[model samples]
Target: MPAARLPVYDAGPPCVSRAVDAFVRMGMAGVTFGAFMGSYDAVKEGYKGTGRALFVAKSAARNSLGWGMFGGAYMGLNCGLEALRRKRDWVNASAAGAITGAMVASTRSRSGIRVFGTAALFSSIATASEYLRPVQYPPTGL
Candidate 1:
């Protein structure tokens, strides 16, 4: 069956575009009333005034599921590719962190930025580590 013979495709490592796009979308979502209210509450508590804004920023980022997933996947794929190339994991982590920082800095709410940032960082680290140590599988004759 054709289905049985379907070939696995390896798309190249994801780039910053995907991560950036995801961050943009997430930032836009922060404009909603819910996000506004949440941001307001956070700011009112002096969370925004102090260096603790990042703590609240993470809370807001969780509202945008689509953006979060895209950013997460981008980091994951980037890490995976880097690992495959046997590069240091920090390289991928730094890239992901930068993307998250951009997303956070550009967005209105610190919560959104923080959450997405965390996702990006973790995804990048995890995927890169996984990719770096790959198990060899025997080839199957098709």
Candidate 2:
């Protein structure tokens, strides 16, 4: 006799999967923002100019550059994860943001610590919102 065909469960529907995936992406978003902030701070401190003009220019340039770099890095990391891990990208991106931001916060004075901590808190909330109200996409069994 032929082997019996096995039943395939739908893995709890696309909605559930998508919701979980969004939550994961939301986590990544927080990390990415944090990492970005941390990196920005590190970049700022790397400068060694004591002159006012050079210092001012370096600070401004560092801020702008950091923002751009962090944005790119966050997207790239999350996209790469999505492609490779076959998971939701937003959560991964949010996590990356948080990590980067925290790292940036770690490399600062006490005042900076307070500031970054506050930023992290707010960013986390924002990320959570992203997860709950995710940007829709075709479900991918994530």
Candidate 3:
């Protein structure tokens, strides 16, 4: 009698898909924030014109692009590190996220304190999320 062979699954596509999903979600959030901020500022200034709407649109678009790039870099780093380590744990993900946050902050600000502060903040959030996430066990064949 011949032995049965199970199908082999590849993990690469799933990682890439997750990265793309992160990019889209982050980009949308940035767009929403930018739009809200731009409208609020416009309203506070008592501006009522097509120009104001245009400004809001531009702001949203710019924010979307910026956030997309940031998310791509962050996800890329996280996934790359996970692939290298062959482990999917919260600590590794948080470290990668923190490093990316610090790098982004350093580019925008000249203050080392600000960079490290942002990094610490991101790390804390990531760590907290890890703790809050529910754990699930694989199904056992009955």
Candidate 4:
């Protein structure tokens, strides 16, 4: 007599984990971009001595932090919403952007503009980006 074996399954990493990945990737990108821009501007200003590096570093640091927060929040909310609804679509992206925008707006000044300005702006940007993205189809055999 032979014993039957049960198959094991492997689920992917958690949403937050993926969100952290996004944060790092986006943050690094932001740091690089800010550094480049700052260096260019600083050089253009022709400020000799140690102040040049200081200005570049400041810009890079600021951008790194801001982008990291934006990426983490946006991806986290998007992933959470997708998991909750069990669907993959732009609605989740839009809602996530709006949520992220609201958070940013709240943290910054202008409480009144939180929902209307920032949230709406982000939601619109997300909607446009999602719409512009190429559609993905599943493999038939999978």
* Candidate 3 segments whose C-alpha is farther than 4 A from its true place: 1-14, 133-142
Q: What order do you get sorting by TM-score, best first?
A: 3, 4, 2, 1
What's the TM for model 3? 0.78
- For lDDT, the strongest prediction is 4
**What CA RMSD would you report for each candidate?**
12.1, 11.8, 6.0, 6.7
Candidate 1, 1-142: lDDT as tens digits: 4223212233322445545654565556643433666567776776745544554455555555545654555555555555465454556655655565455444545676566766566556645654664332112232
Reference-based lDDT, residue 119, model 2: 49
Supply the global lDDT for candidate 2. Answer: 0.52
lDDT on C-alpha atoms for all candidate structures: 0.52, 0.52, 0.74, 0.80
Give per-residue CA lDDT, model 4, range 9-29, as digits (tens): 222347778689878988998
Better of 2 and 4 by TM-score: 4
In TM-score terms, candidate 2 sits at 0.39
Worst 10 residues of 4 by lDDT: 3-12
Question: Per-residue lDDT for 28-90 in model 3, tens only?
Answer: 988998899889877887878997898789889888888987777777776777666766578
Q: Which stretches of candidate 2 lie over 4 Å from their true place?
A: 1-57, 109-142
